[model samples]
Target: MHSRKPFYLLVALLFISGLAASIYRGIEHNVPFLPGKQVQSWAVDAKVRFQATGEPAEVSFSLPEDPAYEVLVENATSPGYGLSITSDEEGRRAIWSIRQARGQQDLYYKVTLIPTGVKQILATEEPATPEPYSWPATEQAAAEQAIEEVWSRSATNLSFAQQLNKALTASERSQNIELLLSSNRPAQLFVRMLNSKGIPAQAVSGLFLEDQRRRQQLVTFVEVYHDGQWHLFNPVDGSQGRPDNLLIWDRSGKSTLDVIGGINSQVNFSMLQDTRSALATSIDVMMNNDALDFSLYQLPLEEQSLFKGILLIPIGVLMVVFLRVIIGIKTSGTFMPVLIALAFIQTTLLTGLIGFLLIVAFGLTIRSYLSKLNLLLISRISAVIIVVIGIIGLFTLLSYKFGLSEGLTITFFPMIILAWTIERMSILWEEEGAKEVFVQGGGSLFVATLAYLAMSASWVQHWVFNFLGIHLVILAMVLLMGQYTGYKLLELRRFKPLAGE
Candidate 1:
């Protein structure tokens, strides 16, 4: 039992494992299983428009990164502007320079993003405590009182930062906080006071992403180090964390855009929402993996497009196997239906069937006449091919003349296969009568039509192209069909007479 069953059992197990792994990976990467769950992506534009004087100009702008989203591409307009992009320990920037400029000018930076919903660990540098700020005598007394008030009530560095932040924002702030914040920015004062308590903190800005945002601006917040990690806090409400929609733009709390010869420089962001296929998004995951160097997505664009069509052949093969083996359908050749189904892909099903029948009928008639000539096999086959080609050419030209464009696709039918089919049917008719010829010929067309429907389905095409492992499952199905020794649906008709007995 073990020896006989092990082979098929192993095949089934491997097929199941491969199918499960493919589906698991697909779901893990957010590939949609059904039609309704469209993949979501975002396109963001950072427009920097400014005015230039009749002098040399230098403009610098800070860039943003969303730790939870994948950045696909970055495009910037640098017409007439000397553009230089560099990132250092401080942060990244885009600097645009020119020799001479005047009047209104515009520059744009755009980025495409796909939300992976995966959090990225920020590469943080050594945390440094901010240097204490100088204060005038009057301000010094108020600052000392404010720090002492919250520090006395706090238990740890984190609580001290939280408490100090609360006091600065409280409706009734102590005299020191009132003086300090009135003279300095709220986030700026928060960082200074946090370091006064020996805690490292940085003022940062985050962008809130939304659909159709016209002129978005950055919101500044403070990041405090606690337990070996940096945590976000709201500057206005002094909340404990950032929002889900927030994208950290600047951690240095420095200027985002800079211009020497340009003035009134400002940055406005626009956002657009896009719904993409889940399979397309899965390709994005593969594109990021270094191990997938040989994936279809890594191929040249032309090859990738070609494989998109080639991959669906397996689906056609599966359909043919089901129709032939499991359903007991008769066909002209073993795999001829599969090839016909492939041709049906380019030429639509209705037109393909009509063209197939018309060509075969006429070719058979001509084949009958040639059969009486006693020609050799090779000569007769060649003659049939020439006749098939001539018939196709005539149909194409007439269709074009009459504006019946659908007939143009008749060229997609395989000339050699049609010729061979016609020759086979003519010989079968001469020996086995017209009835058997029609039965097998109709069955082939029927199976090919079903294969065409299955192969041309959008989801089948997408899945076959996106997940290559699905072929193992298809192979397993064919193997199972091969083992079917029972009566087919068509053969069940014989049992109808037994039921009466």
Candidate 2:
């Protein structure tokens, strides 16, 4: 054992070196092997600049809404300001409150947006019917007459709104409609006139998120409710639908920002497009640490799925090595315990244990009777195979009939291997007596259980799958175990009589 230590140490060194190199390559490539979801994400970084006075300062900015898109996470940097986000009956807003300050101050807020792929237009708590606008007397009659003319030409609510929308914003509009635009914004004016005619309508501001845009202005649209749904129409061209990338902003029709004690307080946006594992990204952001960033970040999702389970097998093998070589667990076969452990993972611990015990106990009874026929070794195993399968079938039917779905997973156990295990235990009982047979059989289950626990662990599964070096580390540990020449833990117990002497 002493002489072989050098060889084992070298093997361990090589495994470590190989693992390091693989991890390095994985890191360079950004093929994430980590156990989590891979999500395509967008980082919308917004900067708000203002010059603060030496008094209390408060800044409020309206936030985005849902059913259009979702804010997955958000963070802000305000060197001297205290930031707080609040939501009310009106809408959600971020408020930065400061006690006192002087000179130019820059406050930054970053929002990560994820497309939900499902749209739902949220209902505001406004009256079931829209309230008519209060306009100056001269404009009121002209707006009402113009809206009446459009409403008369159109039949459906949507069509009336569309026709009205066009007449108000058309480049060569009629005298009444063009005068309305000159004094008021087309979208808002059209909505008020619409309400005057008893149709529920409102103007909304939104952002069309396409490319990196700075100091972007909100695009307004007129929305009319009919048939239990809100329909958006472009105020400029009377277009019927919103852009696929539209983000509804300032929906409550509130001012985007309210600032006191700050001059020229304005927001600028800088956006970057990147993809990350959605499940892992939040954790990564929360940790504020990137020490574990590896190349296995964005490999094909299917390949990542394959490696996750595959990598855990080595850890199971290491468990088997330590149990058999160092602890002297007398399993029926070498390396078979690892496969059993894998099956246990699918079936779960308690159910698998119960199923395994039931099958083996029943198999042993059949094996004893088979021995009476005086058959050859191959014939015996083949006969046991048929019987073991029959046993599995019977158990599955009974379990299913009784509604124990977990027992159905018993099929994942290697049927052939179970047959062999029954045969080995039977033969071992005949040769070494019943006590030894029970000891070895129970030991196999014991070691396999330990292996399952190690492989099924969350962190172990993550490390092995993500870092190709983890298998190397497992190999190194197994090699180190191989150099253990001292008495097995069980062997040491056997020396109790010698010590008693």
Could you tell me which residue pairs clash in candidate 2?
Answer: 26-295, 27-295, 30-295, 31-295, 31-296, 31-297, 32-296, 32-297, 32-298, 33-296
Task: Give the per-residue Cα lDDT of candidate 1 at 478.
Answer: 79
What digit string (tens of lDDT, one per residue) describes model 1 on residues 1-501? 347487689678869976996798577655665544566778888888889998999988887655676666677997898998888877778888899989888889887777767453344566766677766776778777888888899998888888877887788877667778788899888887787767888888778889999899878888888877677778688687757777777775687777898788888888888877666666665666553565677788999888988888878888887887778888888778888998899889999998899899889989999999999999999999999999989888988999989999989998999999998999999999999999999999998999999988877876787677888888888777777888887888889989888
Q: Model 1: residues >4 Å from true position, as ranges?
A: 1-43, 47-57, 100-106, 118-164, 174-176, 210-216, 226-229, 259-292, 298-302, 486-489, 495-501
State every prediction's TM-score relative to the real structure: 0.83, 0.53
Candidate 2 lDDT tens digits, 49-80: 88888778899988876566657678888877
Model 1: lDDT to the true structure: 0.81
For candidate 1, what is the TM-score? Answer: 0.83
Top-lDDT candidate index: 1
User: Model 1 misses residue 27 by how many Å?
Assistant: 5.5
TM-score of 2: 0.53
Best by TM-score: 1
Regions more than 4 Å wrong, model 2: 1-38, 124-126, 278-501
- In model 2, what is the error at residue 304, expressed in angstroms? 18
